[model samples]
Target chain A: MQARFSVDSGDFTKAGSASSAIKRMLKQLGVKPAVVKRVVVALFEAEVNVIAHSYGGFIQCDISPEKVNLLVQDTGPGIPDLDLAMTEGWSTATDAVREMGYGAGMGLPNMKKNADSLQISTAAGKHTEIRMSFSLKEGEDGVS
Target chain B: MAFHRTLKVRENLCKSCTHCMKRCPTGAIRIDRGHAQVEEAKCIDCGQCMQACPHHAIAVEQNLFEELFYFEKRVAIIPAVFFAQFDDQYSESQICQALYDIGFTHVYPAELGIDITRLYCVKGADCKPIISNFCPSVVRLIQTRYPSLVPHIGLKTTPSHVTALFARLELEDKGVGIFYVTPCPGKIAEFHRLAEAGSAFNGVLNMDTVYNQVSTSLAKNKRKFAKEDGAMSFPVMTGSAATWALSNGELAGRKGRSLAIDEIHHVMEFLEFLEENEDESNIDFLELKACAEGCVGGILTARNRFLASERLRYWATSLPSELPEPLVQRIMKQKDAMMDKMTTPIHEVSAIALDDDIGVALYKMEKVRKITDALPGIDCGLCGSPTCSALAEDIAQGQASIRQCTVLRLKDPKEVNTLARIWGEKVTGEKGEGK
Candidate 1:
């Protein structure tokens, strides 16, 4: 089954709530703790990308006995320079956002670091989509 | 050891995103039980977790202000920046009295310690990038990540330490009480360390706590205090002294050869600079600040208009720009004095254990990476972990399980389930999400 959440931008006070929610949901299942932590980091990085650097976006997730998939779609200004944005220390957030400790330019790189077989498709004004896959443990049963 | 609640985890507000783990310098938070919790020893109390908790659920403990009234004198030694919170209404002089009227026996301005900082760092070393040793958080980072450069840190303890030292020495006979008004959680952590088993200061009062008390008084009465000359004994030589309250203030204050940097992102360059000290003498001190603009604009302060911190830069610059005691010459004598103090018993955080068994940790980290890689990259905090890595860590630690994800997991009985269904099919399910 798939679930969706609407994350808002400019509301730094509520920035990572969506990511936190997803982490907890996966934890209740018989999933490995290590994989859960990585997905949470990647997802939170994307959420920050939308709020700090773009318009608010939505986080779409699909879960099953096999693996979990997360998709983040945003209406914000897509990365002007993907390669640069993908770089470790490059960021466009204003000094104000940086003060909040939200823009270290580590968001996309961190997401890519944590996600498996990551795929991202972003256009300047159209839309940006990021898809990631996480495999399940072998011995674990699909009780859900 | 894990707790039913090591730290507060507001599950309803979580979105299960992974941003927190990415930002977590120490990887302390883990997702489970529909929320994230602090991994005690793992949390350095840098308050990055509190800073990143968008839902306001994750917060440092509140203060015992009203409760303090029952004990004794309530002297709030507010950081200098706290003076700026009241706009032009509360300048240095006026507010000292305001604090007096509002249940505090006296208000010890922490900026007073800036004089100690100024007196201590002046003279001696010229053009040798001296990192400011005033922020305990910055100091802790040194201990945790840059142990080799421990020798380079200014021998003087941070301003807060100096303040604590001064408070005890100066107030021992005064018979009055003292409290530290904190703007950052890092300071609270410092206070925790300082005030632990063998301690100094009495208590730490956070900004929110003091703000509540001050706001009430300001709203009720507008009486300003006396305009005493140098109401603050801080030897303000140049506007640069004031700049210390803001970012890059140390750069402006240095009278000798030095470089100034203010950005956490510049850690790599800093490491390289430390490695290759080319212009040896021309760079006595490196006034490196973690925040981009500087201390006046820290993670804990109120969010102002765009670049509002610059206002402090201009205002401080307009005040004056002369250190009472010049650097270069003074630092020479000060260095000898400090050298003895440098050897003083102080904890050194191990920085960049480059040769440590990273492979072991990496192998451990990879397991987490694998699980998180499959989840939504959206750091919504729905999973209660700060990020996906945190959730995976929880699972690895056995604190949480993956079946908790109702959003991604299949319903009750399902032969049609994705992960199990695929895993049951052998080759197709070998590496994918299994049913």
Candidate 2:
């Protein structure tokens, strides 16, 4: 199964509506509660990243009968170093966003941990692409 | 959806023009061929489309005015946001005259309902985040979108629910009629769901129905009603009580370092941002309102002129009426229990855990990720879902295939072939049959 997302640029006031829809769809799909939790957390983190740093982006999902797939793509400023971005404490969020309890560097890492196989492709001047998989095998719950 | 009272649409009366789309606040209308089709997902029940349609193609389902006019004992349950609409009129005075002139035995402002909400949410001002239950659409929005955040909503029953309970209790024997003066689709939906659960919800009147009638009626009979500081409707009514209807009333109501976010998307976005960025400077409480301006600009309001923030501030300051000591004390107390009651996920139920191979799931994901690599990553929703992941999920669900996504098709002439090639398996037969 494939799902698509539209990450509207930050009006700050209207940010999380898309993520909310994703969470709802996850519920309808019978995604495990723990897996849904992980997806919500990770997807929300990526959504905020687009609003705060990039021009705007989208998060789409493909749920095969086997695996759950998520792709976060944005036209925002891409990360210069995949390694530094993958770390948990590096963020370039504005002070206004920090006032609201955001811009922490945990976005990519959280997405990585929730998704079994994570892929990142970014161009500093162009865009960033994130493809993550949360497998649905019996022993595995979700993204863990 | 079945809860709505059916209305007759004059079929041939439609001009088939796209004029109504521009007027709809929630984008509920779309002109197809010649008739207008209402998108259920998008419609907020705000009558802007009706006002916009020149041919009068739109009408409300089950108007309460018909029932309200016939009832023996009718009560007007006004939303706290109602006070915000008329800046010049005094709410205490108008409420008093309104009850008497409208031929009702009592006048209960939904503000009293807020008192009940405060009683439920405020005591935990230190730890619990209070998502306002005044608007039904916001709650449903969260239920559908931010299912995980469902836990964060205050467990307190909405003011409407409490008011419905209170009204039934007050008029035990009398032939009773409860007419809710609604501001938006959220309240209308709440009344609908509440009825589906039992059969208590009586009638609802949008602002367009009674705004003018009430104002004219009150003006005509201002002399008969006695008005000082009227009675409190519930336990939690406050100096800032009406503020709860607008942009940041919840923050002001709870008092500690609180954050109030209105507009459904704004609240969710802030939630996502708070999750990603916030630190030790924890927000003591959170207030969520779906309508940008609180309840006043609901799908049912008479005038849609004022900004939600400005009108909210205007109404909150106008009323500081005195309350009875017992009522004051009752409104001040906090509810002990948490609001987010059900933590269970609402996903699909599978019988024996069919596909449990993490390695296989991972490989399939990698293959899909690679197959769509060359497609434009734009989630334009041209393919149906609002995003790309939804389309992918649809593909996985068998409702749609990868070939349908133009972006994926652009990347490779044969999208399914590409997916099959990446997975190193034959997937064409039996269509997604591998268990």
Candidate 3:
């Protein structure tokens, strides 16, 4: 099964919509709760990252009996330093964005902690595409 | 497996107007054979249907009034909200006296149990943002819909159950009957579930039933009770216990970052968000209730919810801040036993899952998505189902047929007929049509 959703740039109010929809689908499929939580948390962080930092983006989810794969592609001025962005508590968010209680610099790190495998493709002046996969088999990643 | 529920629809009184079907939060009700039918597994017994019915067709099952005579000593464990049901003219002692006149040998406020649990019961260091299990309907909703969050629910038993246990222990040798006077059908269902697990409760009496009897008794002996003293013989409760059934009542003095959410729809929305983002929210505790203003807004309640809540809050101010020493010592005597019962864990009841097997559930979900896309987007509720997606889900589950969609039948009869033949006419009244 596959589902796709678009995330508008700077739309803080609707950042978690895509994650919420995917969570509902995963729950209906009788996926394990811990796996669902991991998927949702990672997707939510990636979704918010696009809305807060990029121009605009879309999320695509592919689900199988054994695992779920996610692709988040955004049009933007990509990261100048990937390693620095992965560090906790390091952010470049504006003061106005910080007032909304977001941009805590936990997005990429939280996503990396939740997804079983994560890969990023980006340049200083190009768009960024993120790929993440979550294994659904019991006892994998301590899900059981 | 079918679970016990208290709400029922009278076939004779149903108008098939689709009022209750639309109001159900879980989409549990569906019109069948020109009458409303409830799917037992899907129902959380929130009483939304009872409140939405125009013809008064929905009724709550309760123990008969005469059932109180089964024991020599009948005790009524009543919530403070029950006293708020009457007009301000009726004093608490008058109502207590009226309960005796109506055959109750003793009257005890249900909040006394809250005091006991507060002092003696040791809470477990379970999941974060512990959900309060005070409201039975909210607990049922979580069990049926959000099964993953089951670990987050507090394991402590509710105040009424604690009070019933206390009452039984106090009168252990008296052969007493402990009856909970409930302001909602959910409590009756809860009592039944607890009774099956060897609880101390004997039966449940609807608040409206007992209210009518007390009103009659009070009216008949108005002059006789008017001259009596205003003092209450029953044990008094702490101020917080008096308002414990109201909205925000449970979170009044609790420590840590807590939130109290009332009304089923709002609670459902918040739970959906919390399920996904549990660790990020930083919430320490949650007090969720199904009714708008908590028990004061129960379907079985008599007075206006706001007025009743005000009365309870006002009454709370006149009471002591702490339980009397005698009451505290009584609770201390049974501390070990109460802790054993209170700490019992609540298991998940994943009733809403499409299938127990993940692979099969995934296939069914894909089918449901395809069917939903083909159907009209408008939630007309003309096909006996609450929404278009619900019908799609039903069809995928082999519980309904595509031919039941009146809109599709009207738009393209040939296409709908062909789809019905492919999907199988499993629905009643549509059989033998596609053959």
Candidate 4:
């Protein structure tokens, strides 16, 4: 099964729709509650990141019996320092975003912690793409 | 332990208006055939269904008369809110004596246990926004609806259970069976939980049932228990802690960040906010009540809750506090006994388990998403469902079809027919006559 949803920057109202949809899907598929929670948490942070930092973005999720792969591609000023952005407290979110409690600099770190495999690629001043994969097997660590 | 729920619907009284179907916080109610059915797996037994039913179709389970006789010595434990229902002239001792006249050998008010628990709560809590565990319904809400915030809920046994334990300790050798005269369905259900864990409480009697009998006995009997000048067993805090029987009383006194939320919907909304805003560590205490005005506004209560709360304010304020030294010693002793193992943690409830396999459920949800996107988002409820999303869930589960949605059927009949035919083929797994 596959799903694609568009996310507008700073649109908090619709920010969680994609993550919620995928959560419902995973729940229906009979995934373990803990696994579904982890996947949803990772996807939510990724979705919120796209909406908070990027001008606009799209979320694509592909679910198989064994695993789930999520791709979030955003049209925004790409991360200049990937290593710094990966830090727990480092954030480039605007003041408005911070007031809405969106940019905690924890989104990437959280996504990394929850997802088994996380890959990132970006062209500065252009765009950013993130790929996260999660294992569906019960009792297994998220990435492997 | 086996799962138990107290809420039930009287099919004869149901009009099938779907009022409860839309209002359920857990999405546990479904309109099947003609009547509203409660899905037990998802139901937290919050008594919201009983309140929503205009026809009075919903009924809660209570102890039978014979169940009370089975116990050797029946002791009634009353909630502090029960005292607020009566006229101010009736002292607390008179109320306890009145309960004694109604089949109970002895009566113990819940204030003693509540005081001890509150003292421990104010002193021992380490986390911010310490969620109150006073309401059993609120505890069940955390178990099913907000599992992640379970740790934040303060460790404390309900006043009823705590009082029952104390009563058992007092009657150590005798076969003493404690029974709570409760005002809400949630506490009635909590009785079973206590019994499962080998508590002294034998069962619960609905406050409504005992109220009429006790009222009659109060009018007839002139006898009253010996009244003491300082009857209350806890220290008087100027702020609302003494009046915790009232809905917002939990917020009285103590300076740090605190919140007292009442009613089920407001509690859900606040909890959702707490879940999202993870950085809010400032709040030191949170008091969440399931009923509109705490237990006084329970479904089984006869008095007007607003009036009862007003009456309680006067009584709670004028009531005297306990003597300092003995009370302090009692708090210390109870603290050591209740440390670490306060209230029993409820098991996680999976209200909605769509399929046996994760991959299959995901596949079905994709189909549901497709169906939802196609339907009109007006939420008109013309198709017997409260919202378009609900219809999509039902359709995905093979309970309904897209043709039932009047908007799609009227505005674009062709689209509806095409979608129906495709859905039919998918369900049957074969080429249909239309194709």
Clashing pairs in 4: A28-B361, A29-B357, A29-B358, A29-B361, A29-B362, A116-A143, B129-B283, B240-B252
Q: Give the per-residue Cα lDDT of candidate 2 at A105.
A: 84
Over the stretch A1-144, how does candidate 3's per-residue lDDT look in tens digits? 999999999999998999999998988888878888899999999998999899999999999888999999999889989999999999988888889988899989999999999999998989999999999888789274
Interface RMSD of candidate 4, in Å, is: 3.0
Model 1 ranges with Cα > 4 A deviation: A1-144, B1-26, B48-54, B67-74, B120-129, B146-151, B197-199, B223-239, B255-284, B290-292, B303-435
Model 4 regions lying over 4 Å from their true place? A10-45, A87-110, B65-72, B89-91, B117-130, B173-175, B219-242, B251-256, B277-281, B323-342, B373-386, B398-435
Proportion of native contacts found in each model? 0.00, 0.03, 0.79, 0.64
Residue A91 lDDT in model 1? 89
Instruction: Identify the candidate with maximal DockQ.
Output: 3
Off by over 4 Å in 2: A1-63, A68-133, A137-140, B1-30, B41-56, B69-71, B87-91, B117-130, B222-237, B264-284, B304-322, B326-435
Q: On residues B1-435, what C-alpha lDDT tens digit does candidate 2 reach at each position?
A: 332312224458877665666554433454444566665644544445565678877666545566776777777777766655555544555654664565655567676655655454433212245454445665555554444445556555566555555665556627787777777655666677567655345777776667667777767766655544454333334557666676666566345677767665575567555433233336656776665656655655655536544665755565564445776554344222223321112222221111244344434444444534633568554444435654454344344455445566566666655664444434446555321
TM-score per candidate for chain A alone: 0.91, 0.89, 0.97, 0.94
Q: Which order, best to worst by lDDT? A: 3, 4, 2, 1
lDDT of 2 by residue, A40-124 (tens): 6677777888888888888887766576778889985888888988899888778888887778888888888776788999967
Tens-place lDDT per residue, model 4, A45-94, is 99999888888899999988888999999997898899999999999988
- Using DockQ, rank the candidates from best to worst: 3, 4, 2, 1
**lDDT of candidate 3 over B303-383, digit per residue (tens):** 999999999999899889998898788878877666677654666777777998888988888888888988997989888
Q: How far is candidate 1 from the true structure (C-alpha RMSD, Å)?
A: 15.1
